[model samples]
Target: MTATAAPPTSAPVGALSSRRLLSAIFALLGVVMAVWGSRMPAVQAAAHLGPGQLAVVLLAAAAGMVAGLQMGGRLAHRYGPARLLAGPTIIFGLSLALLGMCRTLTSLCLVAVVFGIGHGLLDVGANSAAVNLERACRRRIMSSLHCAYSLGALAGAGLAALTAWAPYHVLFATVGILTAMAAAAGLPLIQSAAHLDTPAQPDPTQHDDTPQLQPRTVWLLGFLAAACLLGEGAAADWSAVHLHTLHASEATAALAYAAYSAAMVAGRLFGDRLNARFGPTAVARAGAALAATGLGAGLLIGSATAALFGWMALGLGLSTAVPSLISAAGRGGPRAVNAVAATGYLGLLLGPAAIGALASLTTLPAALALPVLLAAVVALSAHRALDSK
Candidate 1:
């Protein structure tokens, strides 16, 4: 095969350029997701929707995301990652503006579906691209790439907070238009650094979803991913509520998630080096163990302050697991990435609901044990599950 790209240290520089471009995409995606999330309260008020109604809208978007992930995997396999990204990236960008324009439940649901599809497509496409880029550079770049995404999300949330006074429509539309233009400008540079791995011609009759890794490995990796991400889903949905239940003030309750998120960003920022030095299997195992033990103790204690530290421990411990797993999945091929990511995303989608349902049956704190248990399982199983080589 021809050299698709270059290593970071031994580069003619094109691979480095591609890596930077991919980081930008990752960052932009983080910003988009964070901004949308920050404005959910505004959207809910504007559309006059209740909690259940809001759940329905969120579910609609999730359904669309699932569809996009399936399609994106096949497309990335067939088209090469750069080509796979072009359509979805643009769709992702423009769909944001539509989100601003909707005012009714029906309209909002429709827009949410579109937005979710774009988000899902971009998610797989970008990760697939980053994996290939990492391989080209012959280094552990996945964590650093993910760090850009975390930083982007922080930036987006800050932007939304600062612009809280603006109308939702204006805020969404303006950000959407600017990002869409950025997509237009960025696409050509991304496309120029071609990184095709498949043979130029393929047997049309061959099954298209075939992946490079053993089926067992893919599924197990998927399980690890699901387990790790479940903790994240729990933190996003329940940390504040859990704190609120402890009778913490509103401001303090908010800090529970903030601590988690900030610690996650901090962990990811250093993840590449840790992975490079200790290897992915070790990192995953250690991270999972830390999450399980730390968060487990936090739940057992009565103090909200301790809970915040527990979430921080959870965030830091789990921060590198997905990136490490995704990178491993990438070595298995795009179709492997597809299978593993879908399984993981499905877990993320289901995790919060599972916690909520369990909470109804038991106390919320007890239900929170689900993630801790999963993290413990991951800690036990990580080395066997991860394909580090």
Candidate 2:
């Protein structure tokens, strides 16, 4: 006798739910990051740490994130990204909440590691699932998903500011509870076990059941991801400084970062359509070119008002670069994606210091030109990096 199955319409329902669930996952990550960042000063004060000590703690967290990304990629490959998401999601929320209770450096370090692990795992799992979904649907949604993340971060940051008078523990607990609820709500939609039970579709570009990526190609892609992230890091860390260099008032300088962030949100929200119409390589190349042009213009103009426009343009230009590259990395499977993520993270570590070093050697505006050059490299090499050759 044949086994009875649900109606064919069920598949579409499941797919829709899965897509929503992926968006929720990404948003939750953004919320966690913003909440933690806003509450960082409190945590530091509780641990009685100075600026240098706080940097050490942050480095430890970064270390944990790197390790987790390494393991999360391999594990997600073996077990499936959907299945890998659940445990880490829960752990991440719990750790963030627990941060309020850590009164000493040792305890804070331990909790940070735990949170970092969760953060890294969720990052890999969610992005991996996004890639799979895009392949299944055969359209570009990565940019929209990232836009959701940016929106969530904005919302969380706003909430943190509004609730600044509340105790750290209470604020963190609120965020944690919300994250947990989101995870629970999305659990049924993930269908991770179902994915594991079923056979995976073959890659269109590959003949074998397994899609293999070359090591050299993987490294190349990793560097491309890193370059894109380098631009992102520079924008986040130095936008305000660049504005100040143009002799902007303190209040106007403060708006520089906000302008860049707003531009990023706008770019990502609309970028999916661009990706669908133009393709990833074209979109990425254009984005990089625009970023290079904007940053170069800002440096050349040496005016605060012009710099604001330049920063906004830079944000728009770099907005979709990482998403497009990450989606391409997903073609090689979870491990490949992880390699790319890890490499990209190295740029975040280096970005601030690199700018600082260059500033010491030259002028700040001159140092800021490095990201412009990097963007140009991305524009030129995007096709080579994205193709699985």
Candidate 3:
């Protein structure tokens, strides 16, 4: 049932095959969802909803994501990564199309929940597959796999900006098309529906025992993951809004997120090299510092252009932390994947929801400062928390 029990086979050494293909496909799906979600402001405006109503709709998506992530790892463990990968992708594509059709607030909330489930499952399954493929390839391929996700996000943001003047339904339709293409692209990589069992490795200490993650380590990794996800979530949900507050046009405000996405993509592409040279602790520490500084500058300067640049710096700074943390969590063995994913997702789930709640209570500007301060705390603890291999 566990990954370590699988028999070793010579598939190909670091070759581009099923896993890489699937990662790319899911990465594109991730991009589409991110773009569609990022354009929520437009969606809300079109529906004539106030901030409170919009927050409710957003919470539905967040709740679904948390639920799906918690369950996805177990599903992957039971059925294998390929089935887990394909099923959710189809659902994601369908939900995206459905998202375009919803008219009422209730319909929108319903579709958002479905979309969140699909997105969450796809996230956990694809990343699980990527880790497996990397193990088979015997190389550091996780960062590159995540880089694909970042690229997809960048493309989605660009597509959204380009078609902002068009009907929102058209944008959703385009995203659905992209999602379908990604799903189709992944079909060749999936092996079968039946679970394949392999023998567990011999252990002198405990021949009959199964591997499991220590509870304490799982909690620690979860906390670290939450910090990283919260930082990224803050940027994703708020950077453009911050730019708009500084008097940027709608198109230009979107560009603030585009800048962040671009920098993030760039960072992920080179992340492995940096990780090799500096280690996860150093990278995380530096990233935290940069994210905090960028956020601070964005808030203090009060210029649209400067705020955009600051967001870009924040993106570049925060890029490697999540992927690195995921990799570290897996170090304890395959059993750690779910706990790690679930815990990390808890942060992802909370980050935006908390921010929205704060924005409701106080000003959006003041609420934005929360993640900046959190990032600073992460930076200060990076040396101790993230350094564990």
Candidate 4:
């Protein structure tokens, strides 16, 4: 038989440049989601819905996100990240606008699902692109991309808090406009990245040198990711409420999220260096320890300032785990993506629900501590994984 040509080892020229730009656009979208999503309490108040009714609507959003996560990998593989990124972003913006217009619970639930789908798709596309881009650059870039998301989130939350005095509809409309612009900016990156196309068939002459991953490896990473994500999810869903509980005013309550986002951004910006110096295993373990400690301390101290500090610490600690795990899985090979995505997304999907359930059964403070303990478990397991490897 004739020998087959080997796949190219080098990234196409300009691919890295395009990837950086795409990262920025994805960050912008993340900011919009944070700002608008954090304002849900106000939106519910505007709709005159009780807590029970509002919970159902929010659950719809979570369900939609789960659905998107389940399908995102296949879609990205089939259609490529560019189309997957841009199209869903536009849909996300439209759904944001729809959220502003909805008056009844039914309408809100529908909008929530649409928005979740778009959000989920955007996340998968952006993250996949970020990972691929980093691989091409042969340096640490995922942390920076995640930092962009944190920065965007910080800006969005800041802006949302600042504009709380304005009409709620105006706030959402502005978010929609910003997200649309971000979608437009991302379109070019998708066109230029040719490697995102399906991988060529294997060459018979080439040896398969990729490392083999045991099934336990998948579950281990999944467990760690779930715990790390639980910490993140707690901050995203409850920081503002916690602040409010601490007697902060409506506008200032958002600062809780802002602090967490800022910490996340800062951690991510510096994460590449930290990862380089320490390695992914060390980073994940340390991050979990810091998060668990910070969160537990914050809840125990029971001060607004302490809470903010705790949230920031939690953000910093949790920042690197998800990206690091994703990279590890990808390094393991293609089939690993499904397991990584499914496991990671499962943690992400369950975080809010678990917190909400805990809140219902006991106090929010006690529920918040659940993630701290979970994070501790993640750190211990991650350290073992690293040592074994």
Supply every candidate's count of residue pairs whose N, Cα or C atoms clash at under 3 angstroms. Answer: 0, 0, 0, 0
1 or 2, greater by TM-score: 1
Predicted candidate 2 versus true structure: per-residue lDDT over 176-204, tens digit per residue: 87787767766766664343212244535
| Candidate 1 collision pairs | none
The TM-scores, one per candidate, come to 0.93, 0.91, 0.83, 0.84
Candidate 2 regions with alpha-carbon error over 4 angstroms: 1-13, 192-200, 203-209
Q: What is the alpha-carbon lDDT for the whole of candidate 3?
A: 0.72
lDDT of 3 at 225: 73
Best by lDDT: 1
RMSD of each: 3.4, 4.4, 4.0, 4.3
Best by TM-score: 1
True-structure lDDT of candidate 2: 0.80
- What tens-digit string does per-residue lDDT give for candidate 1 at 34-96? 888899999999989999999999999898898888888877777776775667767877788
| Candidate 3 wrongly placed segments (more than 4 Å) | 1-14, 38-42, 45-50, 192-212, 246-252, 297-306, 332-335, 356-366, 387-389
TM-score of 2: 0.91
Error of 1 at 188 (Å): 2.0
Q: After superposition, how far is residue 73 of candidate 1 from its true place, in Å?
A: 0.5
Ranking under TM-score, best-scoring first?
A: 1, 2, 4, 3
Poorest 10 consecutive residues by lDDT, candidate 3: 192-201
Where does candidate 1 stray beyond 4 Å? 1-9, 196-210
In model 2, how large is the Cα lDDT of residue 124? 89
